[model samples]
Target: MTGPVVRKCPLCGKPRSAEHAPFCSTRCKDRDLMRWLDDGYALPGPPALDEEEGKA
Candidate 1:
């Protein structure tokens, strides 16, 4: 088999830690969560209309 591939952290580009898996540390994890809560990330698609609004 080949050597194990090292995965870099998504936030800081540092080597990933076992405890945090994809994230390098607690701070990065919290930062990702905050981004989600603050709407820093968004799904790509057309706006979705409510059922009643669609009928109108």
Candidate 2:
């Protein structure tokens, strides 16, 4: 029989660490956080309207 599947880190493709769960290490985890904090990731959506335009 085959063994349980091992998930890799999304950042470096390394085997995931239990402590970090999805990421392999604190560095990768922090990098992901930085991406979010820096607005490196975004979701698909309609463009936001300006305050002046919305007020009209």
Candidate with maximal TM-score: 2
Q: Put down candidate 2 lDDT per residue, 1-56, tens digits, no spaces.
A: 99999999999999999999899999999999999999999999999899989995
Using Cα atoms with residue i matched to residue i, what is each candidate's TM-score against the true structure? 0.77, 0.86
Residues 2-32, candidate 1, lDDT per residue (tens digit)? 9999999999999999999799999999999
Off by over 4 Å in 1: 48-56
How much lDDT does candidate 1 score?
0.94
Q: Which ten residues in a row have the lowest lDDT in candidate 2?
A: 47-56
Assess candidate 1 and give its TM-score to the true structure: 0.77
**RMSD values, in order shown:** 3.0, 1.2
What root-mean-square deviation over C-alphas does model 2 reach?
1.2
